[model samples]
Target: MSEKIRSQFGCSKMMLPEHCSMLREQALAEYRAENNRFPETDEQLREEQQYILDEARAGGKTVIIKTLNSNGCNHYMGIPLRCDSTGNKIIIRTETGPDLSISAAEVVSLTIAD
Candidate 1:
């Protein structure tokens, strides 16, 4: 059977994974709301996220983010941030400083990393 046919048959037999489906839907919704297009893959999501991050950084905005490191002692001086493609979430480096670190659940409020 063709790959498309196999996917269709297999999809009917199992539920879509929640994370994948949610990311797909979010991508579609954002596309529709902005450019009336749909993201076809996770790579597209990464591209979008990078674009936004670059734009913000270029504009010299101070971004808020959730730290991936659970321990708050790691140095983030030279590492780049990571972002979720479909969601408005970014990972930042947190060190022993007075800067505020958000939780992953509160990532929507991130602005730009300073």
Candidate 2:
């Protein structure tokens, strides 16, 4: 098997450590067979993104999001409180230490840093 395929299936020698190569290959093949698809529309894309976000929230990870100004400077940083689909932005409780709330129109990026 190719190195790329091996790595994708977590079948690398480093990952296996104790498991046999054949066992790793079987596990990887099962995983690949279970999940294989390409989103065909914007709605599908949004669903996938929401699934990821939901998983992150359920995992108890701190979701930090940053909002940038027109000049590309970071204008806000905080823990995302919730996403408002109608408003198309996230409601964040600012980390600036005084219980401030803000609506971030554009999320530059999200980090699930534990």
Candidate 3:
């Protein structure tokens, strides 16, 4: 007589636990690389980003800022308040939350909010 197939465990092929976890990690890394691109690397790009920030500050326009850090990238939208003399840090007044203070070095990109 032929052996019966198990109901709980399907008859399909199985992968090792370690291999499955490794594949998951690889997929996550690829996604992060594509989505979380490194901010401006060259001097010219950095200057352009700074220009956008300055314009937003001057015109009192709401700006969307993307910052990158060790943890990950963060997105903030608000009106610029002020920056230190050296422009090392920036302050933004948010609508729903308390003022957010961000480090200039972490800023990746900026855009005027609609």
| Best of the candidates, TM-score | 3
| Model 2 agreement with the true structure over 27-99: per-residue lDDT tens digits | 9988765553222335554565456556665664456554444334345444555677776765555555643
What is the lDDT ranking, best to worst?
3, 2, 1
**Candidate 1 lDDT by residue in tens digits, 1-114:** 887787977656655599779989999988756653222335554465466657655564544433333233222231225555456444444444443333333322223455
Model 1 whole-model lDDT (C-alpha atoms): 0.47
Model 1 residue 102 lDDT score: 36
Pick by lDDT: 1 or 3, better one: 3
lDDT of all predictions, in order shown?
Answer: 0.47, 0.54, 0.83
Which portions of model 2 show Cα errors greater than 4 Å?
Answer: 1-52, 75-78, 94-105
Candidate 3 per-residue lDDT over residues 74-97, each given as its tens digit: 999998988764868889989899
How well does candidate 2 score on lDDT at residue 70?
Answer: 39
**Could you tell me every candidate's TM-score relative to the true structure?**
0.26, 0.39, 0.63
Task: Summing lDDT over every window of 10 consecutive residues in candidate 3, give the lowest-scoring window.
Answer: 1-10
Deviation of model 1 at 68, angstroms: 5.9
Instruction: Report how far residue 16 has shifted in candidate 3, in Å.
Output: 14
Off by over 4 Å in 1: 1-41, 67-114
Q: Residue 97 lDDT in model 3?
A: 97
